[model samples]
Target: MKLTVVGGGSTYTPELVDGFARLRDTLPIEELVLVDPAADRLELVGGLARRIFARQGHTGRIVTTSDLDAGVDGADAVLLQLRVGGQAAREKDETWPLECGCIGQETTGAGGLAKALRTVPVVLDIAERVRRANPRAWIIDFTNPVGIVTRALLRAGHRAVGLCNVAIGFQRKFAALLDTAPAEVHLAHVGLNHLTWETGVRLGGPDGADVLPALLAEHGEAIAADVRLPRPLLESLGVVPSYYLRYYYAHDEVVRELRTKPSRAAEVAAMERELLAMYGDPALDEKPALLAKRGGAFYSEAAVDLAAALLGGGGSPYQVVNTLNRGTLPFLPDDAVIEVQAAVGPDGPVPLPVPALDPLFSGLIANVTAYEDLALDAALRGGRDRVFRALLAHPLIGQYAYADALTDRLVAHNREHLAWA
Candidate 1:
């Protein structure tokens, strides 16, 4: 099979290359293309990718290019991981929102909305190109604001599925805690992308008995620590919230903390410099250890599994993915994209039925879903009022003053990215 990775210049590419090398038997790729506009960074990352593949004795040919059309032409799948504005823009996204006393994050608040507006149009253009190149090629989006981007792709009628490593990361961590194989542990993953909860942890498969309570009872403190949430909250809710939830659950505290520390974008920029330097070393044939600190844990495994399943290659029948709800959560609109455990195959992800949700989680999910709708609106059809309305809809920035201030800041920081501005 052939696969194309747009934004393959990202520091995260090595981790993905390592996974492709290690899991070669699972996917059996014959041609791999890395597409990026930044030629210098592409050369560094592409060299490392080739070495990683060769070091593992994999026969797949690795190619690099700046042409999206040539990279995606006739490929079995195209993976989107591009950051529209790079780390400098991300620094703005991470800093400006904090001025409004809202948590500064890339995928969760006004900052996330800014990123959505900048990213959706670029991704749509790329998807259209991919579709023209190979109508059968599946588009797997790993970009930030995945739900919004995936929704944009689906609404445009592209053959696409969104991929996130959060579920797989949780699966691996939970398996280690339970002393079981990763495949034997299944998560009742729910809610929207980046805003999800592990409602249940089942063993064997989706049909297996739920063991979430047992895991929580024994390891509540550890689990809470991992996500930086209070142990008491987990005990009370009977579910584990993703780390991103910390921004919502402790908004003021997170804002205070963010104000004191350097932006995550700054730290990642430094890390990328070091990673690129490492990639330049001819002797470095494998993924460096520092790459782990760069994040996207278990992304390679998730990508390989999803791609294999989508392309008729043999793999698990069920996996967690971001796809349309289609009534999986009775509370969400049918078109709302959600991350949940679903059966995977050549036909794509079919979301499984979720058990009845407690009002606590369901209410938040519904609220965020509404905000996402407004955010997508602002992304597709740009205007100051639309931007202000989307910010006002967000639970974290519901106050009018903050929304007004954030809307202005978002536009000012991202004017170059927003064509209508």
Candidate 2:
């Protein structure tokens, strides 16, 4: 099978290449294309990708190009990981929102909405190109604001499934804690992308016994620390919230923390510089250890699994992915895209039935789903009012004063990216 990675110039590409090399038997890729507009970074990342494959003794041909259409043409699958405005835009996304006393984040709050607006149109255009180049190809989106992007793709009738490393990272962590293999653990990952909770941790398979209580009893403090949440909250709620929830559960505190620290974008920019330097080293074949500090942990495994399953390679039967709710959660609209456990195959992900959600989680999920709907509308049809409405709908920035201020700042900082502005 052939696979193309749009935005393959990203520093994260090496991690993905490493996974593709190690999991070659699972996916068996014959041709791999790395598409990026930034020619310099593409050369650096592409060279490292080739070396990684060579070092691993994998014979797949690795190709690099600035041409999107040529990169995607006739490929079996296209993976989207592009950042529309790069780290500079992300720095603005992470910093400006803090001025409004909201947590500064790339995929949540007003910052997330800004990213959604900038990203959705670009992703759709790329998807359209991919569809035209190879109609049967599956689109696996690893881009931020994944739920919104994936929904846009599906709504446009593209064969697509959104991939996130959160579930796989959690699975690996829970397995290590439980002293089991990663495949032996399955998470009842529920809620929208980034905003999700591990409601159940089953072993063996989907129907396996739930070990979440045991996990909490054993690793509650550590898990809470990892997510920056209080251990008592996990015990009280009987579920583990994704780290993104910190922006909600402790909004003011997070805002204060964000204000004190340099934006994550700044730190990542520095890290990318170092990573690219490392990629330039001809002797460096394996993925550098520093890449782990750059997020998207276990992304390679998740991408390989999702792609293999989608391309008719028999791999894991069930995996966590972002797809249409289709009533998996009775509270969410069927069209709402949600991150959850599902049975994976060439037919696409069929979201498994989730047990009844507690009002606590369900309420937040519903609220965010509504906000995402407005966010998508604003993304597709640009206007200040649509932007204002989406910001106001967000639980983190519900106040009129903050929403108004954020809307103005978002539009101002992103005017170049927003055509209507």
Candidate 3:
């Protein structure tokens, strides 16, 4: 089995690799390929994954390369984890939104729009390459702005699935809060990609609804207090929510704070510099002890684990991922790709169904449509006006006329950076 990891130099590469290494018995891997433009980091990770595989007595060929064609050729599955550009570009993605006086966050609102604009073309380009090279290969995408990127590939007509650890990770957290086994707790999720609510969680069978109301009522305050956001969402729906709770649950407060404070873009950039300083060069004289403190498990564990499962068809129910708006959210438009609970096999992914969404949750689902519509429109038309309309139409931004003005300023200031046509 050939598994190709596109963004093999990513900070998360180690975790993903470890995930496969630990699950070797479940899904034996035959060959692992790490592909990244940066040869130095690729070498480091390639050596590391090989060492781990050897330690586990797995006989898989590990190859690292900068060549896209070489990396993807004859591969059964390709895990795309590219950042398009990396953290430096992410700073610009965030900063551009703030300059326009809109809430300057990385994954949503104007920032997400900017990212979609820059990322869609690159993702589509890669997908097309893979399609031409290997017509039946499954593209397992792990990039951020996952929904946007996945939809771009799907619309462009490719075999792709979006994956995220956030939903599964948070589900475990909610299980702990409910004092139940993670597998015992069944869930139904809705909305777009990272931004979504767990519309339902049940303790056992189809009758899982019985446990939801009490679970939410009991943990409501704790969940809200933990994130410092009014997380009435899951509670209102009688379930638990996850992923960027601090932002969505209290969008009002977060929005207000962004308005009152100086843009944190520079501060965030500085922080990124510090992180890169610590990790960018392993040979640097003073590697942060904290860096060493990070276990090898996080290094190459998760990606490898997923790779093994996808390749070997591990029978165990891993929270493998797929992107489709069809089943998990029948209420939403069919093309809206959402990261939801998926059962993976040698064939591909089988998505579980999304439960009925509440009116507010349903509205949030519709809100995301505006963004996707504009993004798909931009990609098809090669223009930014649709993106501008997308920004103004976002439920959060459209609520304020001032936000609209700020968006205008943001586009103008970052016109060159946005590379808008």
What lDDT does the true structure give each of the candidates?
0.93, 0.94, 0.65
**C-alpha RMSD of candidate 1:** 0.7
Worst 10 residues of 1 by lDDT: 96-105
Task: Residues 212-270, candidate 1: write the lDDT tens digits.
Answer: 99999999999999999999999998899999999988888899999999999999999
TM per candidate? 0.99, 0.99, 0.83
lDDT of 3 by residue, 198-232 (tens): 65666663356656566568777776564455556
Name the runs in model 2 displaced over 4 angstroms. none
TM-score of 3: 0.83
> The CA-based lDDT of model 3 is what?
0.65
Residue 421, candidate 1: alpha-carbon lDDT: 97
Task: Please say which candidate is ahead in lDDT: 1 or 2.
Answer: 2
- After superposition, the stretches of candidate 1 with alpha carbons farther than 4 Å from their true spots are none
lDDT of 2 at 246: 89
